[model samples]
Target: MTATQTKKALLNKIECAYMPVSDPGVSAEWYERVLGLKLRSPVKPGSGAIMIMGGGQWLFLLPSPGMTPLTFETTGWAGEGESFEMFPLCFETDDIAALHASLAESGTWTEAAVRDEGGCGLQLDFKDPDGNKYQAWQPPAQKGE
Candidate 1:
């Protein structure tokens, strides 16, 4: 331990995340129907919407004109020379298989298969109707369970 370093972190936890959408009302419904997020606020055509995730995190969808999807591209994550689209938001799930099935039934775009990332557990990447990329992770089961 360093004398200058404090044990307490300056930040507590991430309370919310914001994403740009073409229509807040439509996007809010998609989030609620496909991802099971609860709409916490009334959404008008031009107004923003607040959604509550299973873990109590807040996701705000704001209407923006000509807004790009909240995603970025990098090369090294997938391997050298292979570009990979990275998502700013990574959600946690308990049942990856069921979620995958649900996404499929909804006709959502997703990676062909769920990947086992070893110590990082199972992972699946998908996109919203607006093309906002997101990742879902299912932690590896505990040894005793």
Candidate 2:
């Protein structure tokens, strides 16, 4: 054997991703409808002064604990003030079509469509009205074209 790598990296699971919104409750409701994630609990109940006040692992609903929405100085941010950055949060799924349909059924998807990004992969994106973006992707086929 040589210095060449023999082992590989493996991943288990991703627990959550959180985003900030002006209102947590309302945002949570939207996520539940769009992504099919349940609002099981909150990291903090009344975190913001806003009506749907909360903070936890909610997509565009609330910030993660100790993490607020980005400010002007945050580095590597491709977005303008409150606009979506190029690097949006992505959710991986084997069933992109089903996910898109699920989102469409609820009518909460701002823009959910499937497109082929020049063999980057099969991808679909949906944006919440708040400007938060989420993506579902399937890798390019390794075995067959």
Candidate 3:
């Protein structure tokens, strides 16, 4: 109960992410088959469906008339002259190599081969059926071997 003391921050974590898709049913199926997210509800033509990730986060795929994909380009992250297309969402994985192989076998659109990023560890970038860009990251192995 001091003046210098501040209350705890209200937000702790993100629970859900909303994405615009051309077709809810198709997107839902793609997520389930490709990324292993389970559909929480039945999909309708013009409606949205809730997809649950293994980490318990909900992804809502909503039908969009514009069909705009979720992605943006930035020069800041990649340095001054180079431009890098950033993925809004980055999912953590234990095995980046296996996931890369699976994505390739499925003919998914991946930016490039999985590479080590020093402090960031291994990273793989890929696009969904709707062209939404996303990244998968594998943390560096702990030192103790």
**lDDT of the structure predicted as candidate 2:** 0.57
Could you tell me how far off, in angstroms, the CA of residue 68 lies in candidate 3 after the best superposition?
0.9
Model 2 worst lDDT window (10 residues): 48-57
Instruction: Indicate the TM-score of model 3.
Output: 0.87
Q: How do all the candidates rank in terms of TM-score, highest first?
A: 1, 3, 2
lDDT of all predictions: 0.90, 0.57, 0.88
Give the per-residue Cα lDDT of candidate 3 at 142: 81
Best by TM-score: 1
**What is the C-alpha lDDT profile of model 2 across 74-109, one tens digit per residue?**
344435544433435666666677777877887755
Quick one: RMSD of model 3?
2.4
Candidate 3's error at 122, in angstroms?
Answer: 1.2
Highest lDDT against the true fold, candidate: 1
> Which clashing pairs does model 2 show?
none
Over 1-145, each residue of candidate 3 has an lDDT whose tens digit, in order, gives 6999999999999999999999999889888887778999899666899999889999999999989899998987788769988899998888788788777877879856998998889999998888889999999888893
Could you tell me the C-alpha RMSD of candidate 2 in Å? 7.9
- Provide the lowest-lDDT 10-residue window in model 1: 40-49
Q: Could you give candidate 1's per-residue lDDT for residues 30-81 as a string of tens digits?
A: 8899888999978865689999988899999998899799999988688968
